[model samples]
Target: MTKLTGAEIASHNSKESCWVVVHGKCYDVTEFLPEHPGGQKIILKYAGKDATKEFEPIHPSDTLDKYLPAEKHLGPVDMGTVAAEDEGVADEAEVARLERVSRMPPLSQCYNLLDFEDIARQTMRKTAWAYYSSGADDEITMRENHAAFHRLWFRPRVLVDVERVALDTTMLGSRTSVPFYITATALGKLGHPEGEVVLTRAAAAEGVIQMIPTLASCSFDEIVDARRGDQVQWLQLYVNKDREVTRKIVAHAEARGCKALWITVDAPQLGRREKDMRSKYDEQAAQVQDSDDNVDRSQGAARAISSFIDPSLSWKDVPWFRSITRMPIVLKGVQCAEDALKAAEYGVDAILLSNHGGRQLDFAKPAIEVLSEVMAALRERSLDDKMEVYIDGGVRRGTDIIKALCLGARGVGIGRPFLYAMSTYGEDGVRRAIQLLKDELEMNMRLIGANTVADLNPSMLDLRSLGLHTSIPRDHLADQAYDRLVPPGLKAKL
Candidate 1:
């Protein structure tokens, strides 16, 4: 394989014949330009240049090999002869963010998960913060996810021995240290350079399960290999339009010892995350080509990478999934009782009641609310015992976990909080976050007169105001992170 000179590669640097260097290798991406999910404009900006810095965070290491044909994999580039990409004037926002990072409170000061989020909001890059914090449309559902937990007050029992409170629980036949698992979130490298592997190591240290996302910045094998002995992992999948691609992914996950297959069912199409879209637009504005490009610029990172998800996925595909692997199948993102019952009927091992962390379907009920309804409906049909039930969305504190378990949830999934921890302080931060939850869980259990997980039941919760959609007290930390929505044509001056 001959190494290509920088001058030779630079000559093919237009829409007609584009080439770019990534990780010291050159690739002819001219044919792939139009097919690029993030749009051709981003690719054109890095044409004939080292795109490694831009590419490493958002895409998996195997992206080019998996998506691009072998013919386009040009030989290595002699980087010594390559012209260095111009580093223009420093961004003022970035300067401020760096100062904030320097002034961030020590990890010991973060007593709770929200504290990590508060710190991350002030320290992360603008695009990264926007992508992680933004929710669909008005973000009413996002706020309501945490707020709904407040609606149900606790009913503590007295005159009961609470000397030993146990938080150990099992999900899908796996015993975990706690009843919560780190749920899947995409683009881990956007927050931390090490990506999902950081969560993997943290989960291992804390003795909890980690659900690896299909869109993880680190490759699947990288996360799996990072696991300690007997550390459990589950795969969260977004079904691809190509059946073969989906099959290959499922087969690979099972072969890599993933314990469960969580099929995301709610997101046929991603919701409009305005903050992310605006952030992306701002970054790309200076790079816009003079020509009328057909690429959609309004979609942020969410839509850009999600174009391969099969919108036609239906219940009929359940049997096909079962045929592919023996791993326990879990239907993630189930929002209603009807769907939960249907999932049980389809013979899935579990159903995770979720609304995509309120990133999909703006008005969708919180997973905790949906959990209550589903449990009732399932018990009515004598199907409550048919499958393990789990819920995710706005689970910030141990009290939230208690509420779900009382409502018949086998366990809960927490996504954003852990990501915030990892973003703010890496592996140590994540471990601290888990420890804090454990501390809270034990204290809450002892107060509620529960000695073990089985001791928890619906009797421990007062559901009188559970269904009311009333406003809760203002959350200063969340409000600070939130980007308030403005009415159309009423943009406020920044």
Candidate 2:
């Protein structure tokens, strides 16, 4: 008994027997929950039961599909009762009907209707498809990303008048129509030739924030131009050990009106994506340029990413970056409270809570699960409101966004969902995806009796609603490097 992990003990009792079959695999989550300080309830929520309804609210939030295994573990938790509380959700049959109506084949449907894997299979070449779909090692983390969202069950409060709701919110002191933003991701061109240009422009048109990867398909100027109207542009950078390139990238973004600089630290080294290795994605990527004449220029993506990446950055380069630009500095790949505390001291304006689309590490905790731990740390250090925290990675639906906001996120980000929209249609497809999320968010807002984004608080949540546990550590945590970020004198106060 002492040897059993909370998740493992929970999994042993599941219908799948000896395995919590999520997205089709037997993961030993049993030993994992005790490591998860969030407590055992989270893992128990999905243990020995299917988590389909619990998963619906958090579908698109980047937790990875940890719930598919719950399909085998789903244990008669009465999900219909929970979903019935949401005002905006059409009849279950209606969602099915809408999804069915959305499958009118390619050109007829806008981009947002397709499922995550469907868009990848349809838009990207075989190799790109594999790269986008593949996860590290055995893909447990990839599959778990989705399943983790399933564990975060929604506890709706009915009978409150939520007729007119407010989705308006602010991030980094800037007002936003929705708490959602276009998260930074690598190699946009791989999905469609229209690439970053088509995608960011589509985001800008939607009155949202447009963020670009440092290794963008097009130059900073080109992407900014794509967002010409009122779109907000943010840039993502990887601080390679090389200092010079990092300075240049930061400077280049500020010169182009790029509002924020997001430094991604998760991929200090890349994750082992087995799918891309076997798919020979490089060879398949070459085929796009070979067939460039047939590509869609309106979408604005080049045929290859080889043309853009300038990988040379380091942690030492962060301070030097602040010296060169006034744009808000945001660290994008922070997973723990230690890093969040360090980010505050470093004079970081924000911390992007993420697991890199489950792209960098496998078997790591899901982004949604990590949100509270990071926020708790931020509050402990009194930087909760001083610095913003934006999360991304397994979010697929509007309720997922609402749940994150209630959990203390300044806002949320979506990568795969937008990419899916682009592949399914184009600008129009991407637009539909954003609007659907907005409608869902607002609808849920009204039904839940919440009037504004400010109405979201930890109080709206209940601990008994779930059973969470994981393989996270209770000790041996690292010291936060806050001293490293601030001016020398400020260190004394911390």
Candidate 3:
């Protein structure tokens, strides 16, 4: 392959001859313009220039190979000949913000999950941070997800032999170093250059499962390919309105050896995430060009690509999902006991009692609060152990995992913390966070006098304070951050 000159590449800027550089490689994406999922304008915006910055957050690493032919790959560009493109007018506010972030305490100083979040907030581009942290209107449920665990007081037992503690567990039959798996969070590249691949590598190294998000900037295969051969993985799906696309996605994941399929059903429509809306995220979507086919675009970037998710997904669709693949099909967003029962009746392998991290609906009960009801409902039907139950959202510590297990949860899922860790220090941050959790689990287990995960049960917790009307102390730090991000007009309400 001949080395392409940046000067030569610069000449092909028009729609008729569009070319762009990604990671120093020049590619002729002219033919792919019309077929781009986000639309053609995004490509044209950086036509004949380096698009790596704009491209990394929303597309997979192998995106070019999947969308374009080998001949379109025009080889590496000569850096010396490349003209320095204007970065457009820089915003003074953004410049000052980046400077402030650059001076924050070193990544090594980040000592806990919350510290990672604090660093991430200081370091991440404001828009990306807002999207990752925002929940539905008022964010009551979001706060409750964390607060619920606080409400449960531990009734630790004494006189139990605690010579050595084991944090190893299993999720969907795969062994894991801890009782939690890295849950899915979308648009990871918004925080780090490597996106979900960073999570994949960290999870593999930590001996835990990483649930690949359907809306990930990196494609599903890129995440799967990043896995160590013996590492287990799961897939999180937002069913596309196009059933054929859904079928194909499911089939491909099964073929890739995914152990489970977590079908997200909470987002019939995206909730009104005010922080994201305040960011004018739609403006970013507008920059992408083609409108999403099945959803309303007025919402924001969060909804732009999500327009294709099938709102009509229902019990009837469960059978269809079962017919398509052999992997266990677990509903990812069940929020109440009744729905949890319905999920079991439908024969799903498991039900993840979640509220989409409080992103889908405002004030929806936290998954932990719903776990007791779900367990009781299952017991009534002699299905208590028939279907596995898991929870996610606001899981920041091992004690939180122990609480959920006491309520009969098979395991818990964690999403935002790992993301914040990766956003701050890449894979090392992720590994450190996992090790921190393991350390906490060991210490907590020893203090709680539980010999193993099996020893954790309902008697070990006092749930009287778990009432919805009960007052839980404010997470002052989280509240301060939330207050800072709330649009000025909405500040009065908070």
| Number of the top lDDT candidate | 1
Model 3 stretches with alpha carbons more than 4 Å out: 1-41, 64-82, 88-90, 106-108, 281-298, 470-494
Spell out the clash pairs found in candidate 1: none
Model 2, 178-295: lDDT tens digits are: 9999887555656656577878777777788878876554455667777766567888876644456667767877887777888777765566666665654432233333332343
TM-score for each predicted model, relative to the true structure: 0.93, 0.66, 0.86
Model 1 CA RMSD to the hidden true structure, in angstroms:
5.4
In model 1, state the lDDT of residue 163: 91
lDDT of 3 by residue, 60-122 (tens): 777788668999998998877777766687687678667756566655565568777877776
Two-way lDDT contest, 1 vs 3, winner: 1
Question: For candidate 2, what is the TM-score?
Answer: 0.66
lDDT of 3 at 193: 85
Clashes of 2: 59
Order the candidates by lDDT, highest first: 1, 3, 2
Residue lDDT tens for model 1, 377-477: 99999999989999999999999999999999999999999999999899999999999999999999999999999899999999989889966578999
